[model samples]
Target: MRPGLTIGEFATVTHLSVRTLRRYHESGLLEPAWTDDFTGYRYYTAEQIPTAQVIHRLRQLDVPLAEVETVLSADDPRRREEVISGHLRRLEAELDRTRAAVVSLQRLLHPDPADLAVELRSVPTRTVAAVKGVVKQDDSLSWYDAAMAELDAAFPADERTGAPGGRYDNELFTHGAGMFTVFRPVRRPRATGRVEVLDLPGVDLAVTVHAGRHDDIDVTYGRLGTWVVTHALAVDGPIHETYLVGPRDTPDAAEWRTEIGWPVFRLATGTPERAAADRRR
Candidate 1:
């Protein structure tokens, strides 16, 4: 007998089988402390019991064999900590995605059709203090910030406000790069630098309030477009998004509200009654 247990005794202590212990030995995962030359038997020392327990626990946690080997072989505490921390970060990211999916599903189940607040109204001609520039699609967000800053710096929004407006060119939507504008109400039209003050002629718009982050707001646009089509309206102007509350005003992404406006005209050739009938079908 060695100083401690035989393979069978060690397996009993660890709640593992003799066959599993042998396999572990064969795989060089947990080698025996000593080998009997005469009898060709395996013997493990008392000290090896704790090492076996660690391997068992790690396996239960579903850690890969290679990773387990690396962790076990690493003597440095910092290196092991780094490996565990990396896995934790990945798990946290997955948890966030799972939570977002849950929120989306809940909204689908108890959907409030009215919760998507939409209003159709006519906006009259107005002079707006504006900033316009050519912007790439990838740079749209930055351009929006710069344009808003310029507007605020020029003629900040006050109690006396007209329609907050934006005009994006077709290329901005189709080819992903073109002109953009941000404007607030002004008394007179004029031009300053790339910023051009202009009159926004009267038009009807289907406006919807999106009460959440900018991400996934496209779903709201889709809903509003369907509403317009069913109401016998044809989209005639560039899509405009006016920021009601932004990240700068409230750091919480949950509280962000943006108003999406799509300009439309009465479908010239179509009758509202016919459109309503088609919508029913």
Candidate 2:
């Protein structure tokens, strides 16, 4: 109608729907060059076409409308690139998670028949430097990484005595939040930052090693649980995970070995009754 293009013509040129363009205008993400006062009609100059195209590209990536505005408003090319790159990194991380989920789902649909090897052992008490805290289930891995790094920094290579291990409360898995304690044996225990010296009491446990990536570690846990239910009875104690060979030891995931320990009591006498009672408890 005017010297510039109408909303419909702009949408056709940009390959964006009229509804989407209207939304962008209302959200202040993109504005028409001019609007008629009496008719309330919108008009966009040819110069605004590039802006519409840029908005279209960003929206295709599912970038937030506000972020799109920020990107468009950025004067420096590097600053605009940095903003887009940050979103790309997040998308990449999401892609990785999606791939992992696909693999897990495939394994669930077609499970491996091989049985896990489990052993019962008695552990002795020991003094160690440890860090303890409450962590959400989703944040557990990142928190563990940070805590372990702190412990490693506290004790040098020579002072470190043995492999690192962690104790996890059942509530973490059941209720999505619980206490987590990670400890490593040291030649001489001392407090540093969040780390402190503490004595861990001896306990009997049913243990199984989960090899390779943690992607299918749940399968191993299920097998270990089945073995415990049939041969022994689980007692009240935190689950212990000893990093026999972990990420620090090897870059290859196949070489990783984590010993999963479930505190247990032998079911030699009154097996059925005690087992049922324990289950009830």
Candidate 3:
């Protein structure tokens, strides 16, 4: 009945606006099958309907125009699938952050002092096999992985005395960079490559277990910090994080448990009875 589908007709069929199709053509994302030399009107083919629909779905997922073009122009199906899969992974990480934010907001709106159970402990001096570095906050995660891997290789199951832990200095959070030490408690700590035998000093700590993924670990830190300050306990040393049950031990994030130890000293101004009441509450 007609020579070809006009721009308006193609847009209506694809559920895309006339302006959007025009933009796509201008950007070389989705060019029309034909153009009239006389009137300069654009025309598309019935076969292009699928391509338009695919582009629509990709755009809906917030894929960048360049990435969408890469996906569309990919010759191999596997290559196209890889591009989509990468985008999906990014979306999943964003969803995790959003969920963590929602949980933090709910806790903030409805404060529960008892949500985090704090325990005070006096730890003795100990020796450990550790890798030390001065790293920025952004690089800390990757550095941690490499350091932990080295420690694990050094001490097999038979030699390990305790779970792997990391000691982070206050300047790490205050100045965006600081000394970080990741260590493994072992029966016989030794020096190997960057891993060295270090003597860790004794200290009093107010500790708490942060459950689940670390996406919202900052909320737990906040809660712990609040408790330490209100109970007349002053932070005294670098923060310690012991990976009791971590990703290396289990694939389930829900089962992961991290012990956050805040080094502190008790001020004599506080009443023991009041502190006991606070703990019981």
Query: What lDDT score belongs to each candidate, Candidate 1 first?
Result: 0.73, 0.87, 0.89
Worst lDDT window (10 residues) for model 1?
266-275
Q: What TM-score does each of the candidates earn?
A: 0.54, 0.75, 0.85
Per-residue error (Å), model 2, residue 93: 4.5
Q: In terms of lDDT, which candidate is stronger, 1 or 2?
A: 2
What's each prediction's clash count?
0, 0, 0
Error of 2 at 33 (Å): 6.2
Question: Where's the lowest-lDDT run of ten residues in candidate 3?
Answer: 266-275
- Alpha-carbon lDDT of model 2: 0.87
Q: Write the per-residue lDDT of candidate 1 for residues 53-91, one digit (tens) a residue.
A: 877876666667777677778899899777766766777
Q: Order the numbered candidates by TM-score, best leading.
A: 3, 2, 1
Q: What is the C-alpha lDDT profile of model 2 across 52-156, one tens digit per residue? A: 898888888889988898999999999999999999899888987887777677777887677667777778899999999999999999999999999999998
**RMSD, one per candidate, in order:** 7.7, 4.7, 4.2
Rate residue 132 of model 3 by lDDT: 96
Point to the candidate with the largest lDDT.
3
lDDT of 3 by residue, 129-193 (tens): 99999999988999999999898888899999899999999999999999999999999999998
How far residue 161's Cα lies from its native spot in candidate 1, in Å, is: 2.1
User: What is the alpha-carbon lDDT for the whole of candidate 1?
Assistant: 0.73
Off by over 4 Å in 3: 37-41, 70-92, 112-115, 266-281
